[model samples]
Target: MEGYKKIIKKLLFFNEPKKMERFVLKETSSKENRTEDSAENNAEKDKQYRARRRKEPGGIRKIDRGTDESSKKEKEIQKEDENKRKDSEVSVYLSHNLTSMKRLYNIPMNGDVVIREFDIILKDRAVGAFIIFFDGMTDRKVINNNILQPLMMLSSLEIKKAEEDIAEYIKKQILPHNQMKEFTSYRKIMDEVNFGGCAIFVDGIAKAFTGDVKGWEHRGVERPNTELVIRGPQEGFTETIRTNTALIRKRLKDEDLICQNFEIGERSNTPCSMMYIKDIANESLVEEVAKRLKSLKVDYLSDSGELEQFIEDSSFLPAPQIIATERPDRVATALTEGRVAVIMHGSPFVLIMPITAEDMVKSPEDNYVRFPYGNLFRLIRYFGIALSLLLPGLYIAITNYHQEMIPTDLLFSIEAAREMVPFPSVIEILIMEIAFELIREAGIRIPGPIGPTLGIIGALILGQAAVAANIVSPVLIIIVAVTGIGSFAAPNFSLAFSFRILRFAFIIIGAMAGFLGITTGLFIYGMWLVSAKSFGVPFLVPFGPKTANAFTDSILRAPIWKQERRPDYLNPKDDRRQAPISRGWMDNGSKGEDEDEQ
Candidate 1:
């Protein structure tokens, strides 16, 4: 009835009509008036402020007492807050600890955090206890058989330490987990729980028990996707950081090998493992790496790639100062050389630091193969890098400006090929380079076997189409193709990327002033790279500074037995890696003595 009356009244004459805003298109005089008034007031205030500043001693106004008091009070409040938070130990009260767990983890909302409450049969009576873990992260069988079953059936386990500390009792006898620890700090227990471990809290105990039962789903050890080698171990580093550390340990069983765990990132609290031979690696270098990592103010570190950027020497440098490899053998090689490897949680790629430019061209496969084969491959890889970086520039320069450099027959053939092309040499090369890069990137982005297939087929079809259209010369297509293949041959992915990016710059300079411009760019680029450092080691170590045994293990691989000493630049504690004349049969008893005498 009220709705009908309202509708009828609206149809007749609405009482709210006067309240409705009626549009009156008039000049906004009030806004103009207000602007004038505000301008005058602001001018007065500015004049007064300037006069006050001039009157003040040394143009400095006295601090406000009220603000000072407020600041002091704020400091006191923060100090009090700190004092309150300093007691981060696990509480003896079960309800308080349970409430804290709920508040911290947002219980009832977070479905992944599983909290199971049960009773443990003590010597005299049953004790209230609970275990907290992520559902998918923990191994159910381990928890059921090892943890819950043992604690619930504690009477059969024969607990003789009734008078002992409950936390120690639980750690020593109650829990049969291989890796168990009693953590008094609740934050540490939560951290362990976050990384796929279960935390056990007893009714009266002030410490929590952490079990290492991480069983998260991850890819198994397989051939490295990027750093694949034909003659070396097929196993690659997985997303699991501990697995990576174990892989390194499996390769190297030296007693001095240390894998120290560090928690980085304020919010993410990522576990980073720094592995090195304590006796071989320079103390200062390890300290420097640790300092940089600890001082990082980032809230989250997702991968080693992101971390490499943060801790690296310079961001503007072209070549990568650090080596990021997925092969455990490579990491082990770096560690054996007195370098440090940082393995970030959830990332397969491990970062090996204090690398040199020569290190960029070397590969793990080199160590596995014979010296001759290694030397041959290293030479070819270097040549390929040079080709990838300089081929396009050289082509542009020779065709555009240095025509006489080419043999007469080749020059004539090149002229014949470009005669049908409407674009200049620069444009022709640029078209082919961009087209090749597009094809390569498309191949990578596309899935599985189809990717490689598309790259091959697409390049052939596109090159043929472009040549038919006379958009690019046939010679240029061959040049671009060769350049791409050279790039793919680079051992380090990061170094290859560095060359790819600089290729464009070389192209531009080569086009502008021919060989002179290219040479100048090279000089500047060399200086830029030479000035860069990787954790105090020069980018061109052993090459620029002429260190000992530089050539033996650098660009050209000497026989494994010949690399007797470590690289001089690292300043490692143990200078001699191996005895001279390392091959026992080759020693001949007197050969090494004779060489030593000489």
Candidate 2:
């Protein structure tokens, strides 16, 4: 141990500047050319070496030779200087080489390492070589048969193949049974390998050869259960972007459909893609969405939901400012409307930005049906929204304060129903509303057959039991149930939740001051709705503030022939969507019959 300590001390002495300078100048310079300090130090060291050599003649004596020679030996001194300079250069090279070698070879005892016993001898000269093994990363047979078996059969000489040759060899022979792509840089290769790729590092080369090993695991395309339609394509967006795009492209066979990609996050390297029609879509909207998505500086991203929050106009907004949809038709519709769709690599849902309140209320199914029925359905949705948001609040306001709006007979009936109830009308309504929301949430969270059963049983058993127990009035329970059903009638889940939250506030306001309070609450809520912006577009556009396209498909759907243009809110440069001549088909048919009779 003592001798080993001495050896380590002597090795580390090379790191000291003064000693290093003395050592280098003596070895790398002639006696005449040597620095004064080097000459003096070499002379002292030589004297000590001579004394030691005299005392112990058999032992090796270390001496500095450059300083002891005469002036007539100037030529020799010059030769020695050149030779020493070369030696010094070699020594410096060796020092750096050894330092790097030590760093790479000195594996920490506490860190991760695997000791693999191989029959073939490893080259003793190389110091930085290491073996990396990943548990469960492959079929052991694939590793042994495809990789290790070939490697074990090769001589020590075969370990040093050039990167390109190794890549070509793997492609031709070793990985012949499987498809693989080769990459040059180790960093790129390592990334691929970590994500189920295979990498081979040659003995001498800095670059590593990598093979693509992307696992065959992806869900098949299925009809979007969430965004169901009666008269459109049954297929929907899948986790695979390729599958999702196919669903869209099946509907639109245009070559102009553009899909542009951006790599986000330094570590996560999350791939985000923007899709739009090159001709029909607005370039600025595409650019804006792309710019915002690219500017995100998150550490990691796993879903479109995370990306949506980052890129939305205001992250703190209670209502979802950007609409997320699973339906390809919905996305295609948004693209036609000049809105941008952001799709992430692994996410099934694509986010549509700058969507208005009317946009949330309307469904893709509306466009597929006849205009009259579509108009009727859309009106029902509008009524659903009004009933969902205002019914409970209105009930509380009318019953508590504005009895004039209620008929004497109805008021008498309500009074009789509330006679047994202990809580006020507002309290009873809130309790039932909250209970319905709980049941709805629980229904969604529980799995399969149990979910629907739990919801039905929970609502029925709980609501009925509460009413019969005089915990809530029958009339209030009816109002809460109607409100819950109305909220469900909304097309978007996020919009429904927003309506639910807003209804609670209306209930509070109605309870506080009756009709005046309800009126004030509606007024304030209207302002908030009007003031809200979905990526700078008025939330209540085409309805609350009203635009010319307001009549096109706002509260009611117009006949396809009547809507000659897309929504004006989209800022579509080519506004016209269909031909004007198509509007007179039925009329022209009737006129043609009369002319034929004449």
- The number of the candidate with the highest lDDT is 1
**Overall lDDT per candidate, in order of appearance:** 0.84, 0.69
Clashing pairs in 2: none
- For model 1, give the 10-residue run with minimal summed lDDT: 55-64
What are the models' TM-scores? 0.84, 0.69
Model 1 over residues 1-598: C-alpha lDDT tens digits? Answer: 9999989988999565467688996533243443344778757755554443322222223322331232333345444544333336777878767876775677999999999999877656777888999999989999999998988886334444642466666777778889988787767888899889998888888778899988889999989989888898999999898889999999999999998889998779999999899999999999999999889998998899999999999998989999999999989988988999999989999999999898888888998999999889988898899999999999999888999999999999989988888888888788788888898899999997999999989999999999899888888888998899899889999989999999999999999999999999999998887888889988887877778766788767778888898888999999788887677876676787898899
> What is the overall TM-score of model 1 with all chains considered together?
0.84
Q: Deviation in angstroms for 68 in model 1?
A: 24
Off by over 4 Å in 1: 1-87, 156-165, 588-598
Candidate 2 per-residue C-alpha lDDT over 260-333 given as tens digits, one digit per residue, 9 for 90 to 100? 87777766777677888787766677778878887888778888888887887766545678888889888887
lDDT of 2 at 529: 77
TM-score of 2: 0.69
Q: Name the Cα RMSD for model 1.
A: 9.9
